[model samples]
Target: MKLSIVDLSTVIPGETRHDALMKSIDVAQHIEKLGFHRIWVAEHHGAASIAGRAPEVLIPAIAANTSSIRVGSGSVLLNHYSVFKVAEVFCTLNELYPGRIDLGAGRATTGPITDFALQQDRSKQFRSDSDQQITELVAWLDHSFPDDHPFAKAPIHTIDSHPELYLLGSSAWSASAASQLGLPYVFAGFINQKGTRQIIDSYRSGFKPSAGRTGVKSPEVILSVHVVCADTEEEARRQIAPVHVMYDNLARGIIDAQMPAPDDAVKKLGGLPSLETYMKGSGKPPRFVAGTPDQVHEQLTQLSNDLSVDEIIIQDMMTNHDARLHSYDLLAGVFDFI
Candidate 1:
């Protein structure tokens, strides 16, 4: 029943990346004041619409700006960098903020093309072993390794504490891995909605205890999805039109740095003859929820109950900064978060 925010640091057209980042901090502070649980920034590369390409660099500024509500990466693409380096960066953050930081890692890439670009820029291997990365990351955080291991000889500087770690994913494989490792798991319902009930069930049923996850002997699950809340259900649906258009554009290889105005997006939707039909179809369930505050609250509550999750993290892709802020405020009031 806990609520949290996930900011994509999405760039609005006509605004600089600085503006988006500043808005991110503004949103973080706003939610913290409203008594939300946490605000996690996302990682997106080669996308003009997303400004949070480097969460490691942004986390410090955000943590400094907000007094409470935990601030961390929605995920650092673990496949892109070294485990030791990733551990070092977050370890430093934890040293500064102590218990106020989180380390959510995932295996997402910007795009197939961007994958090639990142590998070339870093001059490192592109393929990843998420299990190995997680094992090493936990080992580094604990400053413990098997007696015969190389890291045992040259220990990384130990900290009095470690950042709270969570595995982020939209797949069953990820659920199983997080469960087996006894780490908290976040299911990206917005990214992929198919078979989520089964996924959560699998995660809980498969959970195993580990020294690294003593804080969570049982499975901890959070369901993250896109949400657009407004004063009226109809208005909310209209406001989310641009977001739907944005998804369609991305699937078609079109990327816009800023969210197109909802009115404009409605007009553009006419060109896609099958778009309306797809929206009208009842065969596939939606990956997002758009409604008035009360309506959204009901749906979100039902979603959490259905999946038996501990928390629901809201992800909003709306363009209007004030409206985006208001959405969280409305949800807070509905959920009695304060």
Candidate 2:
């Protein structure tokens, strides 16, 4: 199976945003050298723990720093912006990076408070905007808008270079949309870890072809999940401790996105009355996999086989930056991704 990475550029305690960004570049270069397939930077506005608020700005830096390995926004939340502008920005990125740019689109909303902060007001039409945006964005890329379409008349900075488009979704709604649009789809398994078998099957069954689109004719799917691989099972579990803390905090309405230090997580968990109950996984989904190289490989292979996906993108979330890089390095060696 093909392997890729989705770096949120998680900001650990005591690390500034600058540090997180620099580390993103460094990790990009490291992964390129290690023979990984791609590295996608995430977009999370108004979140303290995630430093990558603007993946478009980071794409050029990452592409320039590495000779290969595709770079992209794991997703640009399309609901908040103009589809025309999104098309222009990624067209420009494609011109700069040529064959290495990917335009992955999603519908995640920055909380209503942040939406007001950014002056991104939403009318009732906002719910349906994502489908329209994706359709228009693809037309803009191919310069294929209907002749009578306003955009066809005005044009949006015509360009020959175009980025490959992928729809990012956690459920069947997005999956069906991608299939119908003839675009590649990425399932956010880490977010919607349950009932995935039906989701993927539904996507394939709903697929419709758009003439001359190879991805549409023979759909491609990628699965993104939280993973941590270490030298041993015990060590890997220790590495993911902080990740659990971060998730627990978020579920409890804590806004801090900061990754706590491992020791800090241990101490903090002692007082969190919900920690024990949460770990017991009563109704929790299987959202993550943490273990030694062999163990992780087995689980990942099983997941890929069961879902029949073409690739897997690891969402790197380790508390320590070095450990994060090490995990990818180990996965590369195990899978011979190079």
Candidate 3:
């Protein structure tokens, strides 16, 4: 029943990226005081709506501002970077924050143009070797590289401890990869909710602990889901209206649109349907959970139990900053996190 958070540093309408980032630090401090376990900022590129384009930079900022909450990347896109460098960065962060850092790694392409832009070698086709990257990254952090390996001589050891590592994903392949690597798996349920149970079950059934690695003795799963909680069901739906519109805009190839205010989004969408009906009619895996704290608690508890996950990481992108904080605060009270 443990709860954590994944913040995207979403830039609300009329807000600057700087505003969004400072708000992220405020969010980390707010949630830490609410007794949440961790807060991981997301990494996205070339998206005007998202300010967390580099989690490595944000993690330390958030960690320095908070006293106890674990801070890390919701994921650093491993496909775009070198495993050695990624390991070194997190190792350095661990040296600073000690046990309060986590390195959640995953593979994804931001977009064709941005992906190409991220490539160091324009002459070569982009490599899709995140599987190998994850393996090597773990070895680097664990200092488990073989004596003959080229990276064995790399001075990448941590002083006191290494950041806790988790594999972030929304697919069966990621689940299996995490299991093979013997790392904790975080399923992005907000992104793709279908086959969630099966994917996590597969991860657990196939898990093989990495020899000489110092974390995750057994398969551990954390489910990250979108949620909007309020004092009443009607209010929750109102708060969630902007998120619905944001998704709709993304579907329509409107990538640069900032999140609209809830009332404005509700007007744009011609009003929202009842939560139950909206979820059932979407014909897609439920994209988000929205309701009163009691209702959200029930749905989240059911999702956690059904998937047999150890923790739940809540992800929400609401336009109203106070409302967003309020949503989490209400959930904390409901879950008795404080």
| TM-score versus the correct structure, for each prediction | 0.91, 0.91, 0.94
> Model 3, which residues run further than 4 Å from truth?
153-160, 276-285
Clash count (model 2, backbone only): 0
Distance from true location, Cα of 307 in model 1, Å: 0.9
Model 2: lDDT of residue 195: 49
Shift in Å, residue 125, candidate 1 = 6.1
- For residues 1-338, could you state the per-residue lDDT of candidate 1 as single tens digits? 78898898877767878999999999999999898999999888877777888888889999999887898888998877778888878888988888899998898756667887766465655675577887787777766678899987783455446788889998888898889888899988887776677787899899987676322677899888888888886667667777878888878878743567666766778632121111222222256777888778767777776677768788987777888888888988999976
Cα-based lDDT for every prediction: 0.79, 0.79, 0.85
Query: Any residue pairs clashing in model 1, and if so which?
Result: none
| Superposed Cα RMSD, model 1 | 3.4
TM-score, predicted candidate 3 vs. hidden true structure: 0.94
Of the two candidates 1 and 3, the one with more favorable TM-score, higher being better, is 3
Residue pairs in clash, model 3:
none
lDDT of 3 at 146: 87
What overall lDDT, based on C-alpha atoms, would model 2 receive against the true structure? 0.79
Clash pairs, candidate 2, are none
Tens-digit lDDT string for candidate 2 (1-338): 88888998888789898888999999999989898889998988888788998989988989999988899999988877888788779888988888899888998767766665544564433343477777777777667779898878773355566788889988778888888888788988888876466777788888877563324677788989888888987677677788788878889998765778776786777632221111222222257777888878877887787678769998967778888888988898899865
